[model samples]
Target: MSVLNETYTLSNGVTIPKVGFGTWQIPNGDAAYDAVTTALKTGYTHIDTAYAYGNEESVGKAIKDSGIERDKVFVTSKLPGEIKDAEEARRHFVETLANLGTDYLDLYLIHAPWPWNRIGTRHDEGNLEVWKVLEEQYRAGRIRAIGVSNFDVHDLTNILDNAEVKPMVNQIQYYVGFTEPTIVDFSQKNGMLIEAYSPLATGDLLHNSQVQGMAAKYGVSVAQVALRFCLDNGVLPLPKATSEAHIVTNAELNFTIDPEDQEALRHLSDSAPEHFHNSTQG
Candidate 1:
């Protein structure tokens, strides 16, 4: 199948692929390395990983194995919440590059807004300093783009207020089941891209009745319905996979969803309960 490659123009003129291979739950080593290799060979030009994920070496190995030119792929990673201070943040970026076997990243994000009081509380006021450091990295060309993840409207606005280089993207927990329109609207207005992690709801919404019905009408899988839902709404979807079949399936997002179906899914989000790692156990 032909790979679906949609591009988004960042505020600074860098274009990133709309569909990225997310490596959140995947661990470090052979398995993770295999997944990254498969994803790249299957035509994924964008890869999303994090310092917290502990799989950068595996991802690096896969990229090396593919023998593909490094400039062709857009690689992204995050600064851990615990390392929010400037010196630690700078140190973390260096270590992240060493692990990924790259000198610079396509994008880098503040993993979260000081969650768990690791850097500071989510409501803490020190988060702006962290964002400032990331902004500096972007200016220095060490990181091509800088952004944040898991930031709500308030956390984002705080950064915007103090930032020299506006954030290029905001990676967040958004999907068919837990869509946050407010965040989308706010980010787009400011020219920051919204990268929707868990775009399939971590498989929680794959078998949902609404999703299933939509898929049947469109003659696609429920997973496709959810992924298309994100793409249609302008949120770049990052789907995870460790196998060839899953990677290929995700790359087949070239078709458009029906207008009525898109509207229906938007309404469904208002009533659907949230599902993720944190909510699943509760």
Candidate 2:
């Protein structure tokens, strides 16, 4: 089967496309629309966007223009990180649906445990309020599955302990040279699929000579090796690309890394000289 057609079933039995086309840094107008349209043309079945990304309208329009049935494609969007009120979350979900020109979302997520500006502040109570709203929507069939992004153990545990429904997924930053092993292990054990944002590490891995050497052995781009690393570790990868060429080739994951090479890739997590933290996780 083509990698594009492969999927991971959410805990709720919702099937999500393995490679989610991300619309993170893209602008809201023609850029977002054209990129999404290109990805769909190149055979990506899953599309990931966020309220914070400010391109939901364009992403939705691109999907509509692609001529694919809505059911044939899986769509996901995030609730803004700042929304802790139940009513606000509810209202936003409606707005998201309208923006997408759809009736139900394949998946929806809390953008983060805390607002983007207040990253580390504890929001146990507030997060619970948002989760309740997500739960309400999921139960109502408006959302097929619900999850979170950028949530660590403490954030996830708060919701797990307090809510009737556990988050079905946790989207985090995972790449060849970076990972949150503790959070990954904890969330998976509790039945959450880890969706990896920045799976390409914001194109940073492409400039690494060591990573380039490794990719040369497989005759695959560094991006493919990085994406396959996420898949091998059982994490879904959401990669963003604007050019048609990049979007087409990004989905090509027809090769696998041997155990020894995979180990070398894992070791780079700590040893890699430079790292970036300026990108948003939505």
Candidate 3:
């Protein structure tokens, strides 16, 4: 069977596709619509988007147009991080459902512990308030699973300590060089799955000689090597692609990296741009 057919069960017993298509830079309208349609047709069952991405409407349209059953596709969206109040979180959740033209999302996430512009400013009390709203939504069946993105250990602990529902996943920048092991370990230990975004390090990993060597050894694209590395380590990789070839190639994960190579890939130094830290560190 194709790897795209595989799944990982969350702590809540919700099954999510192992590989997901991320709609981050893809804008709304025809561009986002076409990209998501192409991904669904190419065998991607999981689609990741955020309100911050400004493309949920197009993403929803493509899924509706694909002629696929809604239950077969896992749709994920994130609440805007600026929402620190329960009422605002509830309002945005409804808007997101309307934007996606869906009554319930497969997964909903707090985009970040802090607002995008206020990275590193730990807003524990505010995040807990937003998380409480998420818990209410989840209990109401508006979301199948609840999670957080770009959250660090401190941020996650704050929620875990006070949340009625623990986060099921923590999406972060996990790649060959930039694997935040401390956070990854904490999430896993606490029964939260680590969803890896930018598994290819946003195309920077392709240039790394070590990554290239592994790709050559496995006879796969560097993108494939990077993604498979995440999968092998039990991380769900969300690789973004607008092209059909790249989207199709990303889900082709039948090859496995040798154990020795996996260790090397894990310890590889961070090659991500400086701005990535500024944007992702929460």
Candidate 4:
């Protein structure tokens, strides 16, 4: 039996499980399939993957193998940064749906603000076209909600300015460290739900004094402290795990940090250790 459970409601009234299994580095093989199966058996209902990850097919297979109904789980996939134009974006959507073997996506995100390759060479202009295309999909009921990832306040504002349908979610790299205060507040003020990836600071804060102290005080792991910070701060956190222990441990984050502890954690963000995003890690 699984014990980890937390949830948040998106701007579109969709209730998303706050804690999810992020398949960022889980390779598409027996290990990947086993990891996902373990995560679901351990009570994870949210699965986050991307076309760039090249494992959506395996993820779909894993879910189907688990005997879990499609609607019982919340799956999120992203558009590869290279396909940023309307036509390519439309093709990307169709491909992702086919790969995942799902008719409708619970949530779909524009993978990143930084476009890749030379497909559509107009920078953010391609993103706008992609957004409109996704909007059309949402209106057609192929995608339940549309959102963006790695977008700053400027990118979000630009979309809002020209979009016929407002984005319901913004998936960003947020943790107690690297809070991105302006973007966080701006999204909240505009009624957009912020889904946090790398919310554990990619494991950088697992042994920090603040988090460790809170963990010792609360009798939980330091990761739980960091996860509690994100959840309590109103950011929906999706921490990745390839093992069942981590999947369960990451979900066992329903603890609390008092006001003083929360403040200390916030202050520690300034002294955040190096490689905050783990960009250097292989």
- TM-scores of all predicted structures: 0.93, 0.96, 0.97, 0.92
lDDT of 2 by residue, 120-165 (tens): 7778888999899999999999999999988888888899889998
* Candidate 1 runs further than 4 Å off: 1-3, 116-120, 123-125, 270-274, 277-282
- Pairs of residues at least 3 apart in sequence or in different chains that clash in candidate 1: none
Off by over 4 Å in 4: 1-5, 116-122, 270-272, 276-282
**Could you say which candidate leads in lDDT?**
3
Write down the TM-score for model 4: 0.92
Q: Rank the candidates by TM-score, best first.
A: 3, 2, 1, 4
What's model 2's TM-score? 0.96
Candidate 1 minimal-lDDT segment of 10 residues: 273-282
- Superposition error at 217 for model 3 (Å): 1.3
Query: Please, what are the lDDT tens digits per residue for candidate 1 over residues 125-244?
Result: 556777777878787888988888777677788888877888889887787757776777888898889998888777777768877887888788877777778889888889998768
lDDT, residue 197, candidate 3: 90
Worst 10 residues of 2 by lDDT: 273-282
Q: Which 10 successive residues of model 3 have the least lDDT summed? A: 273-282
Whichever of 3 and 4 has more lDDT, that candidate is 3
C-alpha lDDT values of all predictions: 0.81, 0.88, 0.90, 0.80
Specify the poorest-scoring 10-residue window by lDDT in model 4: 273-282
